[model samples]
Structure formats: structure tokens, C-alpha cells
Target: MTTATRVPADPWPAPRASGPVRAVVRVPGSKSGTNRALILAAAADGVSRLRGALRSRDTLLMAGALRTLGVGVDTEPSPGATGADWVVRGGLGHGDGGPVAVDCGNAGTVARFTPALAALTRADTRFDGDPQMRERPLTPLLDALRQLGAVIDGDAMPFTIHGKGRVPGGSVTVDASGSSQLISGLLLAAPGYDRGVEVSHVGGRLPSGPYLDMTVTDLRAAGATVEATPASTGRPPVWRVAPGPLRAHDRAIEPDLNSAAPFLAAAVATGGEVLIPDWPEVTTQPGRMLPALLEQMGAHAERTPAGMRVRAGDGLHGLDADLGDVGEAAPVLTALAVLADSPSRLRGIAHLRLHETDRLAALADQLGRLGADITVTEDGLAIRPAPLRGARLDPLADHRLAMTYAVVGLAVPGVTVDDIATTGKTVPEFPAMWAAMLAGPHLASDNTG
Candidate 1:
């Protein structure tokens, strides 16, 4: 077992809002979309351009891994293009060399998605990540690959995929109850396999359904023929991909809606309004459920010309919701629920135990330290209205937990977050963005540009 070094930093005193906070926030491009696009682009037939992709730690790791596999991921903005544009030149047949190392860091996308990509190359690729990553389950995906004729050593992080320059892809059943990423990773690399791929889920209810939808959507956008069917009588859900060429194309990534959770929840917590510009009118991202969830929590959510606007409603209230489909939203929602007038029951998210940290355990421990009534149920969290106090909270190096701390700190003064730097995993400028949102009552950008 590789023991990860625990980096320590001074506690960040989370800023408290005096009154209603009003701002217009523009978050960075989607981390999910950026990483997924990077994978697809690396497998594309020609050069691919990605405009407005997130320049965060996770996306950077994905880009770096692709480059290690002999793919071209460069920063060459078009003649008139603005912001960050990544030009990927594909056509690298699997591995370019042997004995390569891929650092997955703490990004689940890199941990789960890159292994399949590594199997397509004829190189010795070793995948590893932070200490916490070594605990995440990769057996299902690895076993599925093994069934498809891939040589893999080890069942989790710090494993090696001995690429034979090709994968004899065929039908394989995976119990992806742990994560939907396990499924998306296989489909992203399926188009390049010798016989294509067919993935069937034979596990508990799949978590993060929207992420799977996003995968299929991105694959089709690249002109890859993918067919997905839900579970029928006496059958499991299946996704089939035909071996074909993935065309290179330019695409604009949507803003990270998941990143918007804290800011929007901030508005509800402080009895204010936040207008998030460039919010997609239609998106398959799980964060799309935010508006409806916010409305249920006594916040008014609507779409505007600028973007989605969420305003404080009558008052914050607890909610009973099954977050199996949107586990990403649970952390922030848990923070908000603690401040509600009643108790909240957030269920259907057992897989959260396998994330960067056991989010449920962390939430329960940290929130309880702050004098909140929080309990970890079998499948989710039960939070009751309680008086919260300022305390030094540990996010355990989880980005989402750091953001959750920020949301709780908005209404509860004197609270500080430890290891706040973890937010760099996705939103690199989360601290600055959080400070700016509380600095004034005017329209502002999160500096995603």
C-alpha cells in the first residue's frame, strides 16, 4: 500500500455574510465534459479542438495522461478563438512506449476512465493516485476488461494494464453499482477497440445516471454509433458501441453546473440571489437537477437571458430526496440541509462511501463537530435543524467537501476550513470566487476566464 503524504495548511477562516448576498457568478467550463472530451479527442481520427474547457487539476491530469500515450494535447488557440482552447491531435495507436506511469491524482475520472485507454496501447502502463484513490474500487472495470481479453495486473489503483496494442472487445457484464464512471470509461474507448464493445450492468441500482447519459451524448457527438437500452424484464441495462472512426470536431463545453451548487446554495443560505451566467438551457449533467432541488428547498430558481438565477425564497427547509442519480450534489445539499428549519433525509447514495473520501462519514463527523445534528444512515445522511458554531473543519482533501464547508460557513460565522486547497481539483479559483461572492452585492464573475 502506498501511503500518501498528508499535506497540512493553515486554516482558512470562511467569510461570513452580513446580509443578503447578490452576485452574478460565471464558473469555469465543465470538468466532466472537459475530461470526457479529452478522452474522446485522444481517440479521434483527426485533430480535435476544445473551446472553453476547464483548466483544472482533473482535466490537466487527463490531458497529461493522453499525452503520455503519444497523443497531442496542445494549447493553440485558433486565429480568433479566446479563453483556453486545447487542440488534440489523435491517431496514436494505443501506447507509444512501455513502462509509462499515469498519476491519477484524486480525480475519479482519471482513475476510472484512463485504465481502459491504457489497455488499448501496446505499452506497460501503471495507474496510481493519491493514497485515498488506492481505496476506491476498480475491480469491476478491471474484471470487465479482463473478460474482453486485456492483460491487467492488480484490481485497483496502482495497477498495471499490460497493453497488447489491441483489446478483443466484446460483450461483458459489470456490476457498476459503485460508480457510473466504470461504465463511461469503457464506452469512451470502445470505438477504437478491435470488435467494439458491449457493456451490461448486473449490479445494484447504478449511481450517477446523468454521467452515463453524458458519456453516450459525447460519443454520438463524435459520430460514434452507440446504442443504450435500459433494463428490461429479466435483463440488465446494456450499452453497445460499434468499432468505427471517431471524427474530430470542435466543441464548446458547458459551465460546471456542479461547481454552481455552492454559490447557488450560498444565495439560499444568506437569503440572497445569485445569477449564474452561461448556464446551459439543456444539459445532461447531473447538476441540471439543481434548479428543481433548490426550488424544493424554498429557493426560487429560473432561467434568464444572462443565465440561471436562483433567489432566496420564503426560508430554507429540509428535504427528503433520494440522491442516487445526483450524488455530486449531496455534499452541498447536506450543508444546506443542516441550516434548514426542519430535518432532511438524503438517501440513495451509498456509493458515496467509495469517493475521494467517505463523504458521508466526513460530513457526519465534521458537521457534528460544528454542533449540527447529522447521522449516517445505511444508504445516506439524516440532517436535522441545529445551531451550528464555528470550528476548524477538515475536508479530508476532498474538493466537494471543501465547497460544502464554504456553503456552511456562509451563514455560520467563525467557521474555518482545513485543506481548502483541495478545491483546485476542479474549480482552481474557488477561494477567490467565494471571497468575491461575499465582497459585494453586485454582478461578478468567478474568474473562470
Candidate 2:
């Protein structure tokens, strides 16, 4: 396996595109898919092989967390395989594995998903993360776990799960408005519970429906019976998982469509075209809406044999979008909005406030400093096109922000992203990929699988 370049401590002077760019970018497998697959595989019966699993900080953290709980997660590729293959040997019995501490490292999947797994172990599992992750929401998930008969201490990070070796799982209602991962966490770990679990979302608004759908699909693939009901006009969404044996199933993870957002954005920003090879014919990822979103922004998006191809249209224009389900893609889409010709209103993404950083505030403050007409609304951002100038951007160690700044840099020179290394959180080779896209032609990616 090729190791990614060591990220520098200084600001990254994002390279500018001299003209319209035409390139092919192959991003790593989905972080969401990889993490969920690891968790499912770890909780399954027998050994499973995961091909094209993302090898990034988040997925690594998840593997480490499962390993801490006595599950075997091997990262050795099989013979003739291209990229990394995670071989997970399941059968984590209800043993008193004593005490262990898991470092979440600002990965939402690590922070949100691991707690339920911890609830199944007889270990005194304590979960904590970086300073910023300490501020992200966990109470809703923690409280729901408590309802499922897991003894947990602390409201957020630095919390401990005192498991009695098995969770007395039952129905629990969670306010999952802040994050869909909260609900996914419970569902992923539900099969191991004594009574399985039935989760209901009775919060303000359940965000990221596609992510929840992704979770259900993975669970069903593992032979666990799952029933999901979407929210209606007055009824909240509910998910039910029946206790059963989860069979190990080897599969290839899809390329991260969310990670491909900025590359597509580069095409729109530069009046160029970029092809993302290996785009899945169908996916539950929220980023599946990226091509449609870009098309609305005056970009032509077409799916080919290679993958999804996005090319600049006649001109870039502002968009009025409700990004509730795909809020994670908002940062990169926001980059496109600022450069558009008209005003843009992005609503239904208030939950972004609790992500890696206060993304909404960060976007407003940073873009405002860059002379862009941007405002932080109650739910989203209101941006108007203006003359943007290059400036040093602070991503606050947020990976999305780092990529967002890089997209802006393609159009506006002198843009530097502080802590550009933070992109390692999801896209380990983001800087390299950005450089390759700027150079044009077929771009190399970390995963050739």
C-alpha cells in the first residue's frame, strides 16, 4: 500500500487553474460505507473481506475502536486485489474485556457509531476525541443507548459505557435532528442486543435520510431483518431491527460521492469538465444528489461508462436549494454559490452547526473576509455574488472547509487553507488529487481497486 504524503503544518497555497480543466479523479471509497461496513463486519458471524474500503483517519479510527473491543479487523489486501481489503473476524462474545479508551479524532462516525458497540461489551469503554469533537452533539445518542440498557456516564465526549456484556435493547426515541449518525449508530449495534432495537426519531427534523437508508441497506445485507418507516406530514420516522445472526458478506465499497463534490465544483468554477470514474450506478449516499445540484447551478452532468461526468454549462448561476438531506455537501456547494452570477439561498441545513465545526459560521466568516456577500441564516446561508479576493482561510481543522477553500482558490488566487492536512479526515490524498486535477488528464487516486 502507498502511504499518503505527510501533511505540512503551514498553510497550503491552493494552486490556481490556468484555464478550463478536464480531468478524471478517482476518490477513495466512501468513508460512511467503510465505517458502517467495518462495524457490521465486526458484529457479524464468521470472517468477511471488505474490498476498496477507505483507508483514512475516520475508517482507521473505527477499525481501531472495534479492535479495542476484541474484534479482529485486518487491513491486508487479498491476492490480486488492488487496494486495501479489511478482513473482519466477527463473534465478539459478551466477555468482560476490562477497561479501554477509544480516541474518536473528530470523526463523527467514530464518535457516534462506536458507543453502541461499546454498549455490547463487558468492558469499561470510554470514548473521547479531539477538542473540536468534544463539542459535537452526543447526548441524544447517549440517552438513547441508556434507554437500551447501557450504563453510560458523561453527556458528550469523555463519556464511558459500562456494559454488562450485553445490551437489553428495546424501543427508544431519539432527537436525531442534529445528526443522522445518531440513529445509524443504534441500528448498527442493534443486532447484537438481547432484544435487538426499535428506534424512533421524534426530534425537530430528521436530517440526512439517505444516510439512514444507507445504514438500513448495510444491515439488511448482513442478514439482519430491518424495517424502516419514513416520516410523513405528522408522523416521525422509525426503524426496527430484529435480533438475528449477521452473516459476513464480502463486498466492494462505492467511491465517496461526497468527497467528489469539490472536484465537480472545480469543473463549474473553471468552466471545465471533470469525470469521476467508478461512480456507482445507484447509491444511498447523500452525495448522489451532487450531479443534480450542479446541473441546477448551470453545469451539465452526465453519467457515462467511466463514471459521472460534470462539465461547465453556458455559465455558473446561483441556486436556491434546501440542503437538509445532503447538508454534508453544503460546504463545497457553497463554494460554487459564491461564484455564481446571482443571489443564492441555501436553507434546511441548521444541523450543520454541530458538524466538525460550526460550518455555517465558519463559511460566513471566512467568505465574508474574502469579500463575498454571505450571511448565516437560521437554517442555511444567503450568498450573493461579489468580487472575491484571495486571503488566508482558516478551516478550523475541518476537512470539508479545507476542500471548500481549495475550490475557491481555483478561481481566486492567493487562497491558502490553514490545516490543509485536516483533509486527511476523509480524503487522505486531497491535496494530491487537487494538484492532479489542476494538471489535467487522468488523475491518480489512492484506491485503484
- RMSD of every candidate to native, in Å, equals 3.2, 4.6
| Model 2 misplacement above 4 A | 1-8, 78-83, 442-449
lDDT of each residue in 1-449, candidate 1, tens digit only: 12256767889999888888889777888999999999999988799889988888898899889888888999755343223788999875644688899999888899888888888888899998888888887899999999988999988778999988888899999999999999998999999889999999997989999999999999999999999999899999999999998999999988999999999999999998899888888899999999899999999999988899998999999989999999999999999999999999999999999898899998999989899999999999999888889899988889999999999998898899988988999898899999888875485433432
Q: After best superposition, candidate 1 residue 151: deviation in angstroms?
A: 1.0
Candidate 2 per-residue lDDT over residues 127-243, each given as its tens digit: 988888888889999999988999998987899998788888999999998899999999999999999999999968788889999999999999999999877888888899999
List the candidate 1 regions with Cα displacement exceeding 4 Å: 1-7, 76-83, 94-96, 441-449
lDDT values, one for every candidate: 0.89, 0.89
Clashes per model (N, Cα, C within 3 A):
2, 0
Candidate 2 weakest ten by summed lDDT? 1-10
TM-score, model 2 to reference: 0.95
Residue 315's lDDT in candidate 2: 96
Query: Which candidate gets the maximum TM-score versus the true structure?
Result: 1
Error of 2 at 298 (Å): 0.4
